[model samples]
Target: MRVASEMGGVGGTTVMLAQETGLARLVEALEGTAREIDVTFARAGSQLGEGLGLFEGLKERLTTLSTDLSGPEIARAGTTLSGLAGELRAINDGLLQETGVLQQLAAHSKDASQVLERLLEHMRLITILARSARIEAVSVQAAGRDFGDFTSEIVALTTQAQRTIQNCARDHDHLSALLGSALEAQRDFEGRYGQALSALAAKLEQTLVEVTGRQQRSVALTSDAATHSGKIAMAAGGAIIALQSGDSIRQQLEHAIKALRLLAAVTAGTGEGAALDAEARTAAGIVLRRLEAAQLEESARSLAQDADSIEAALALLAGDTAGLLDLVRSLYQGDGGRSGSFLADLEADLAEASDLLAKCDRARAGVDRVTSAMSTVLDTCQQTVAALAGTVSSIVLIGMNAGLRAARIGTGGRSLVVIAQELKFAADQVAADAAQLTPTFAQMQETSVGLKSGGRLDAAHFAALDQAMSESLAALRQTGDRLAATLDQLTREGGGFASVVAQARLSFSNAGAMSDLIASGAAELERSVAEAAMPDDPAAAAAAAQLIERQVWPNYTMVGERTIHQAIVGALLPAQAGAAAPVVVAAPAQDEADDFLF
Candidate 1:
């Protein structure tokens, strides 16, 4: 009877120890899971912070960009650009008119040049007549003694006339050169300069329209991004709150696990079987209640919801960022080859226009040169005509004197009189030719004056137009570059924010999975505790205890606690009651509150 009683005591102690060990293992598992959850929650919080930081930074930049776009400066710039475009169009129209005028002037100059060429031919004829007169005078020198001086005076006048004719020919050549240059310039203006100006004006108009549209889009996108950022921040805040809640739940679980371990230790140390049983039953009930009320499943669900919210917010932000990227890209891309980018096209067009304007200026200068040369020709012609008039009067007076002298000298004087009359006729022809040239000279002078004035006006317009185009294009390029850079930064930040959100999402998923696993383990522990509390025969109880110690406890044993299995097995199958009580090997010392299962 004593032996049976001792055996019962040994069995009871073994069962109690087994229960305590199992509870220790369950507590350690719970503690380890709680620690893992806490760490995951912390990491998730950090990721959320990183995501929120990126979002806030991006929001600030976008807001600033939007503000700049809507500011008075941008409005003024747009207005200035519009005004410049209008001015360019007006200038282009004026240029077209000026080009037409230049064409007309070139044609008129050509006609005038033809007239001058005719006049030059007539002057050459006069030179030839003068040379013939000089030769005749030299040949007829011996025909009359008194006619020699008169003939010499006639020869001097003819030589002077020939020199004047030569001067007129030189002036005509110079004028013709000037006119040719002016004509070439006008042709270039018509073909290249005019077309470039028109194209630039059209491009500016298109650019202004596109820029205005992009500005509006940027404003709208920025507003939307800001709004979305607020949503994202709210979502991150929620996730942070959820993570904080999870951390609190983890702490609660740790405390509950510590309490369970303490209960197990108390149950194991107690010597009375009934008290140990009652304590074990109480511990099981407490653990079951705690497990039911722990609300870990709720935390997991909340975390999942928070993760979903973050992902959704991130998606919206990504969409907005993509839209902004598209807007930036559209600002610079062009339609075809050679027109590589809008800025590049504008720069090239402006450069070509500037060169064209310079050419126009040079052409105008050529017109001025032509005017100077024509004026010189007119003056020379006037002087020559005046000299010829004087020369003709001298010849006529000399011819009349020779005739009088001839009448005195009789037959010898008769030949001299005929020569004098012929000289008079030649002088009359020269005078008439000079008279005709006067009107031609006046007409040429007037035409040249008109051309000079018109050219000056055209040059002024070109200068103003060129300046306006350069300024407008430069400002537009600068603004566009700045906007593109801002958009690029926003895009990069958006990507970084998305990455952070992704990491947070992954962390949340892992934490949720871990939480679910812990919850399941808690449920299983509760079921095991309930099963252990049921009434069973000694053999069955021992079997149950052995099964739990060997199977369940080994699975949850703390790291570096390999001897726990031997301790548990030895406790379960102690030596026969009289066989030194199997040395009752004690369990390894463990600070259950601080220990972990994994």
Candidate 2:
């Protein structure tokens, strides 16, 4: 029985061991699956992180660009607006630069304009020479050869003047292009940079306000202590000592107040009517009034020299009050004295003014803080402008160097003459190009002006284009989806799927091609319209003669005309399976002898 028990136990142990091994295998499989899932999740997270990094980079780039453009836009707008005195100084700088360029151009124009003047003078001289030739029948002694030579010389001179005029025109065009590019770049820079600077300034102003608030509390506490000390000294009947103590206290309080005022001026939200400034002034005023009205003869005698302290406080308060009143007057566009009853209503007026002043000062200080921050941004913009100006200067110098080669050409030399001719030809081409570009520039200017003023046509056109595009795309997508659903239905049902697929494919292919054509043609159409009213190409004129020669005369005048009857006949001819025969119409005759031509 013991042997049997051992065998059973061993069997049970083997079974248990086998079960444990199976469980371990299952656990290993589950762990492998879990690890795979973890790896997948980790890969997805990494991909997301990379995408976010790219998005952040794009956002930073856009922000920087927006800032650069905004500054120039604001600068330009501020100059245009008389109310923005803040930007007047900046605007003046831009004006100075523009004026400098204009002065240079005007000077250059004076010299180059002489070419036209010379051309006219030479023409007059040629006319005189032509008249002299007409006056004489034959060779006029020694002057005949001279006249011929003079004519040739004058012609050459005239050609040189023409070439010079052409050069001047080319230069003018180049200058115009440079100026346009510069202005556009400047405007873009100003718009972006100004917005960024303004935002930064606002943030700085907020920071200043928090700093100033803490400082105000310190001043208030010091002034209160001085008041308490004076009150205690007066109660003790040591009038002389009390007055001397108060005098010292007042001076200390004044110094503290002044320090607070200086801090308030520097802080954001602490401007013309800052609460701190108003509170300081009010405290000083109260102390002065009480000291002046007090009946302390002994104290007065001892502190007689200290009277200046009280007077100083009063003066400071008065100055602040005057300043507050002036600010109010400026806002309302009126004189405070003209109100006539301001002093009579002093307490109410003072209280209201003090509150207003505090608010104004805070607001003004905030604006100042913002402006200061903006100045830094403007400095950066100026640096960028300087860089751009350098690039423009380089471009101008390169173009000028190219122009200088034409100036060295001598009249008699064939190579030099050809060079001069080519230069003049190139200059004429430049004039033509300018003439072509001027209308486009004018149109762009008009469009910009319209945008600024909010014109109706632009709004209407944009709205129409947007609506049309959206509607068309929606319709196309809906049709395609419907066709796809139809094909899916045909396939599932196993009924005529092949025919339906072929029809749908053909329809979509045609629709897509049409859509592409229309989209591509839109720009081409606009260009064609703009060019339609301009001069025709000389090359195309050659084709016109050929086309004219290919024309065939019809035996009947009616052959070219296609009326409703003709259309009906043509439509019926295929159905009838007959050759199309021209229908002849008889013309109305004034007389029976007139031959029929139709």
Report residue 579 deviation for candidate 1 (angstroms). Answer: 49
Candidate 1, overall lDDT?
Answer: 0.56
> What RMSD, rounded to one decimal, does every model reach?
11.7, 57.0
Top of the candidates by TM-score: 1
Cα miss at 210, model 2 (Å)?
Answer: 4.9
User: Can you give the lDDT of residue 575 in candidate 1?
Assistant: 31
Candidate 2 has a TM-score of 0.18
Q: Write candidate 2's Cα lDDT for 442-539 as tens digits.
A: 33333223212332222243344335434433443443344334323322322232222233223223222322332222232233223222113322
Query: Residue 443 of model 1: what lDDT?
Result: 62
Error of 2 at 555 (Å): 99
lDDT of the candidates, in the order given: 0.56, 0.31
lDDT by residue for model 1 (1-598), tens: 0111112477767766666676767667677777776777688678767777787777776776666555554455556557655655664565465455545545654554554455445445544544454455454555644355655666676666667666765766666677677667666666766666567667667766765765686568665765665666665665555566665556546544644554454454442223334333343233333333233344345445644554565455445545544543453345442224444554565566567567656756765566566667668766776776786677677767866766676664565666667666666665666676666566666555555564344556666767776776677567557655766676688778777766765665565466566566556554544433332234433433332332223233332222333343344334322232223222345335324522
TM-score (C-alpha) between model 1 and the true structure: 0.62
**lDDT for residue 302 in candidate 2, whole number 0-100:** 23
